[model samples]
Target: MAGKLGRTGRWAWGGLLVVPLAVVGFAVAKPVKVLPRLGPAPIFRLVDADGRAVTHEQMRGRPVLYSFFTTSADDRVGSVMTRHLLALQDRWSRGSPDAASPTPLLVTITLDPERDTPARLKAWAERVGVDPQRWLLLTGAGLAVKLVVGTGFGVYYETPPGNYDSRYVLVDAAGEIRAVYRGPQLDVATVAADLALLQREAAARGAARLAYAAAHWFACYPVR
Candidate 1:
């Protein structure tokens, strides 16, 4: 009986060692690098360019990218970001083999809704060659826009002075804000990588899912 107990102790120690070894291995090798879950994205309800009501609840179960831009004929940043996202199809699809749909939805919210009505947004969409099915340009009452943009997203948007910031937010399928990109220094590649990480996590299962959870718990983020 003593020998049996000693063998059991050894097995227990072996099991204990596996966890630390796994943590160390994850830290060193980083087989999975995940974007830190920032927080829950704010729930919002607004109107799409087609006068259709869209809500945060509606976007659940799908990864969503959100960008804010005031209605401006000269604001090339929005169009540039759109073009970059469109060009990143191959990059997003690199590892997502079983992703029911590899391409995540893009949502662009207009800051100047008072001037940019549904008709104007549709026209702007056409002007920029935006695919309405994939990308949604949204606008609503000025107050509602302010509530969602300023309070929810913490983005600054005001007219008259035309002072605003260029930014993009990456939200996971679970409606969690995983990553945020801002300023002129930010590029699409960084967002793409973080988003790929999110998508991979979404489609992961079994041991792979456990590995990703371990990666997250261990803070095994990729070196940037």
Candidate 2:
């Protein structure tokens, strides 16, 4: 009788362990949850390096990655980030021949208008090897640009003297601000993963949003 009882106890214990594991495995298998939307992107019109007018309307229906920088010699983060943004496209957007679509466009706006006119931006673009087709270098009325970056995009910056924060803003296809990265916190892998998640969410027709909300409710963020 004792031997039979021991076997029964062992089976009970195994069932207890397996039940929790199965629950965890089910949670892990759920669809990826995305970051919550930050806010609506601000409206603005600016000129690109090629002297063409660029507006928020034109950018609609496409995801955009934004960064504010100056042509000033001290702002090295701009160049470093430019390299990272380009790599983001090369690594993730350019998938196989059957890739669905290219990655989001990277928009770099100059905080210094006096020094970063369209002509100057064009020169800087060439010097930095920026592909005009993929990356846009924009400069316009200092106040308008400042308003768009500061008030519209919610990025902090000061004009005239041209001082600004080094940060990146990721906006979804619907012109909603989604993710923001700053300073050393920027991670290429994280950004790429988030962008892919956003794309999937946009395509999910409302089902993914509910799943994401459930994940958030359960505090199901991935462990580092």
Candidate 3:
């Protein structure tokens, strides 16, 4: 009788072990969305619409949603991108006031600096109904702008011979490039979701920080 009881206990333990192993196998096989750590954000000097000097160093310790545009035309290139970005700002601000640190800044860097002077940027800001307190439009020397946008951000754009990639780059508070969105993938909900996730990860500490890092390592972004 004692031998039979011991045998039953061993079988029960073995079954429990199989359950955990199966779960681990299933998790390993499951598809997970992961954001690639593109690289460090480029540091550069630029002037905001308010004529304030904003530098890459100043942008550190806060998440920034950055987009490039030229007020040269109201085409899909510039106008469409601005509309989508503004929508993201609205949704994010309304979702939770605490969802972002540094108050969730939206930076619009002008590719056409010669035409996008501070005065021009101020005028454009007025036309677009931008709340300068939240949204910032920046312009600087041609070479500096080109280096920051093209070489630093990995965005392709050229002057005189016009070519541009309409995209948005999300930089985390730690100044790391986390994700890029463009085309049909650009949407307020998606941007907002990513922002919230990154903010939570940024604010985490101790074991929580470890968990967030693990999620990044495992590429745990949600499927769109």
Candidate 4:
């Protein structure tokens, strides 16, 4: 009777181990949805630094890092943030030769449209060493779009007369607004890590889609 009890205890312990292993295996096999396949991205019809009309549809395929700020209120911190973003763009652009696609797009939309004119944006770009082809400084006609986009991305700004603050928004490749980096004090390392995660997520999704297509094709022609 004692021998029989020992054998049963051993089987129970083995069963416990096997159950968790099976659960882990099943979880590993499950597919993960990288980026929310959120319906079409929000539309924006803003004027670029060159005074040309640019739309959200035109920027679909590439990831966009958007920084929204006012030039009039605390240009020093805003300019510093812009320099960091430009540095990031330079780093990524340098890796383009090895990458499947070129550098990601950067757009700086001004909340203080009244002051941030095309000429001012051009000067700011030159001061920060921003590439014209990769970085765009956008300004819109009315305050309504600014409020709408800002609120949607959780960017809080109180532009009462004679006082202002800063807010930055980062949009991913799928055009989905992924993060809102607030305040004038921006951490460069944190921003870089977020951008890296976005790139990895996008690449993983692309790879999964390609694999799915290949599997579907093979199913139609088995033993090929």
Candidate 5:
């Protein structure tokens, strides 16, 4: 009886080890990559350059990359963010279009809404030569913009905006904020990688979903 009990204990331990080993393998191999779910995106209703109401509900099924900018000419943060996003836009557009996945939207919300009118935004979009359909330049009421930029995104904003930090929020298709990127420098490749991972994670199902879920838990994102 003692011998039989010893054998059962060893088997139980081996069974436990198998699951852990598999988990370790999954982490190391990283077959299906995913970005961590940050939190629920702030509910917002802002207008675009075309004077159309662009609400959170409208953005529900599409991934949106959001940046806050001011019309201030000397705004260095804005310059860097603008260039980075333009590069991303070019890169994304040049790639073979994927009909299965929803086309991503790039949004730049002006911090100086008092002056950054819809017409101003439209002119800026044209000046930059960005595809107006894919990239939207947005401006709205002062209180509304403040609410979305400060309360919603938790970024600093003051009138006559003197140098707001460069930050980008990546909100996923299901209306969840997946990643927040900060700093003056932008890595287009890494951002591209993260976006790809997000699109893949969104379409994952069955065992693939489970693996992606695991990656979402363990991975810090921008995983190759």
Candidate 6:
């Protein structure tokens, strides 16, 4: 009887471990999809590389592609990511003569305020080929606020004294959080494609507004 009890106990312990492992495996295998939509995006204020205060409210009426980063030891991925962002900004800002309206706005917010000063951010921007008119790099005061915003956007960052991970977040014009890319998981081609979608959306919104205005004006004049 004692021998039978020992065997049963072993099986019970093994089942306990296997169940949680299966659940975790299934969760990892599931795919994540981020839908593109317009809504009131979360609000935050930070000082830009030019020492100017920038807020989400100021970015309203325009599509915003927001990227969040920290200047910690794990910032090696940031240079490459920034390059991709700058390329998209250049492409969108130069209005296609064949196309109507301007492209979306690009905003980069630094998570490490203690280390990423205005001078440092400006130098980084130059290194990453950021255009002053199109791309704005910002930094904030405390980690608490940054963490709260980052969490709200589904961006994760870890700093183990000397090590860190870079994360990026993309927000749309209607103030809605759209996409989040972490570390080296993102590529230049993907970033460009995402920006193109945003540009098209912005153009459509602009056209709708112009049409409404024209209709109102024509109604008032009643052309003979």
Instruction: Tell me the whole-model lDDT of each prediction, alpha carbons only.
Output: 0.78, 0.75, 0.78, 0.64, 0.81, 0.62
Q: Which candidate number has the best TM-score?
A: 5
Candidate 3 clashing pairs?
33-221, 34-219
lDDT of 3 by residue, 1-224 (tens): 99999999999999999988865764565333345577998998999987889998877777788988787764457878878876766765565546445567788899889989999999988987787866789999999999999999888887832668878898887788988887423777777667767766767789777655656666666666
Write candidate 4's Cα lDDT for 1-85 as tens digits. Answer: 9999999999999999998885565345533323223244468787877788888877777777777665553567676777677
Indicate which candidate wins on lDDT.
Answer: 5
How should the candidates be ordered by TM-score, best one leading?
Answer: 5, 1, 3, 2, 4, 6
2 or 4, greater by lDDT: 2
In angstroms, the error of model 1 at 189 is 3.6
Better of 5 and 6 by lDDT: 5
The clash count for each model shown is 0, 0, 2, 0, 0, 1
lDDT of 6 by residue, 1-224 (tens): 99999999999999999988855653444221223443446677778888888877888765566676654446666656666776677666666322553456777776677788888888877776778788888887766435545555545555422334455666665677655667545565665556555554455456564543433333322111
Off by over 4 Å in 4: 1-41, 96-98, 160-165, 205-224
Model 3: residues >4 Å from true position, as ranges?
1-34, 95-102
Off by over 4 Å in 5: 1-13, 27-31, 96-99, 219-224
Worst 10 residues of 3 by lDDT: 26-35
Off by over 4 Å in 2: 1-31, 96-98, 206-224
Superior by lDDT: candidate 3 or candidate 4: 3
Q: What digit string (tens of lDDT, one per residue) describes model 1 on residues 154-211?
A: 8886653166777888898898988888742456677767767787888789999999
Tell me model 6's lDDT, rounded to 2 decimals: 0.62
Q: Give the TM-score of each candidate.
A: 0.83, 0.76, 0.81, 0.67, 0.86, 0.61
